[model samples]
Target: MSKHGFFQITQKLFLRDGDKFLVMRDRKSGLGDLPGGRMDEDEFFEDWYLSIKREIREELGANIEIEVNPKPFLIHKHRVNEGNHPCVIIGYHAKLIKGKIEMSDEHDFMEWVDVKKYDPTPLFTEYMLDAVRVYLKEYA
Candidate 1:
């Protein structure tokens, strides 16, 4: 909603650990999700990378160490909640530099999924699976 208008902008990271990437289970939806969220209103003024870092810290914990590629690997636009709200999600590639993953309240579980052997689950949305495939094609 910044100067950009009505659509909400979200940033998601494919946090890599070797051939695997991290995914979390949303507490509410029971869906597999990535490790980022909507950008805060104030964050619109700062660099997008900072917003991404902040989201990772908030979701995965402040002490978690990781390195994110500044360049985004995927961009997707979709409607949220039965098409009531529109969103644009930007996805990036990152690597776990150190520290074990700790879950935040928003998510109940976390797993490192091997991209090469990934199988689609009902817990993942099509775009989520597509994002993984995109990562495999370009980054992995």
Candidate 2:
């Protein structure tokens, strides 16, 4: 059987402290991941943007505005989150439009880690970080 591909949606949250991006830690996975999820069937990208925005709000409790295909990262990739479903993560540069972050059940916590500080860990797949590395060099 051909592998069923789910439409993965993710928002890249970026706040430049001079020149770095804000990355989040998924509490369930204990790994660094951007804010995103799968697109409901037939959901348009613009509508999906709001879905992503709402998700991040509920998770981090911050007002964020996201633009689709907003500077694509080499980060559009997948990882195994659940044994059954592949996580399709997309990266986008986001500006913090409002508020402070308070973690919800989804993530252990959050941080404004520097881009240069990213290191691949057991929790976070190397493919994801590899995307970050590609974005850094390609965009820089």
Candidate 3:
């Protein structure tokens, strides 16, 4: 293994409500992102579900209950801008099981988008666009 040993692992949720999917504009980056974050140091890789739930609770709200699919539909590897560190993003399909959306400071705006009609190019990164394409072709 290289000195860097491991890549940062991030879990993203494709939270769908009928025909639309949730998208949020990050407060810091000013870029659109899916609802999720990097796995914490204390989190076990095997317990991705719990990590995802925790991320959702933190980024969205603790009152929200999202049913995340354990299997990831998309995975992408890239270097994050923050530290020029290699990262792996795992995307999963999810549904809103309960509660209302209460935005956290992490995001500035939230919207439900119909991928078929919306162009993600302006708001998201290429890797995120790749996930959107996969979602449209296979899952949507």
Candidate 4:
């Protein structure tokens, strides 16, 4: 948790298997979301990518590469409570490169769902669903 104005980076990974996009799922919540995490005060974007890549590798064991896409599909600004404790999330697209998924403790399991029938559950906030819809449209 860095006091820096910005502290997180999100990526949209499109895992292709033959002619399909591989969307991941949460083990416990069972919601499809991007592979991303927070950036420390000492870490930059590149460092964040490496750290998150390692995390994704460890969590899902998926071969992932950071896609050079500056444009974020959803730049959501949300706060559960107005306090000094600031919490925010910014999501972007980062397509998958290679590798198979292996669930980690962070999630109960994972899923490679079809984009056409993609649906968000109660676990995912509206902001996250916004990002998914954007990806489905562009890739579908």
By the TM-score metric, which is better: model 3 or model 4?
3
> Best candidate per lDDT, number?
3
Residue-level error in angstroms, candidate 4, position 37? 1.9
Give candidates' CA RMSD values in order. 3.5, 3.4, 2.1, 5.4
Error in Å for residue 90 of model 3 = 0.8
Instruction: Assess the local accuracy of residue 31 in candidate 3 as a C-alpha lDDT between 0 and 100.
Output: 76
Per-residue lDDT tens digits for candidate 2, residues 49-102, read: 666666666776665443345555444656656554555666666556556666
- Score each candidate by Cα lDDT: 0.80, 0.59, 0.82, 0.52
What are the TM-scores, per candidate, against the unseen true structure? 0.86, 0.70, 0.88, 0.59
* Best-performing candidate as measured by TM-score: 3
Question: After aligning candidate 4 to the native by TM-score, how far in Å is the CA of 80 from where it should be?
Answer: 9.6
lDDT for 102 in candidate 2 is: 63
Error of 1 at 80 (Å): 3.8
For residues 1-140, what per-residue lDDT tens digits would candidate 1 score against the true structure?
55755987889988889988787887876777889988888999899988998888789988789999898878987444334468788988889999976678989988887777776465577666676567767765
Candidates ranked by TM-score: 3, 1, 2, 4
Which of the two, 1 or 2, has more lDDT? Answer: 1
Question: What tens-digit string does per-residue lDDT give for candidate 4 at 1-140?
Answer: 76647323433344455445545555545555555544444556354555555655666666544343445545654322223233455555555555555556656545566667666454455555665566667766
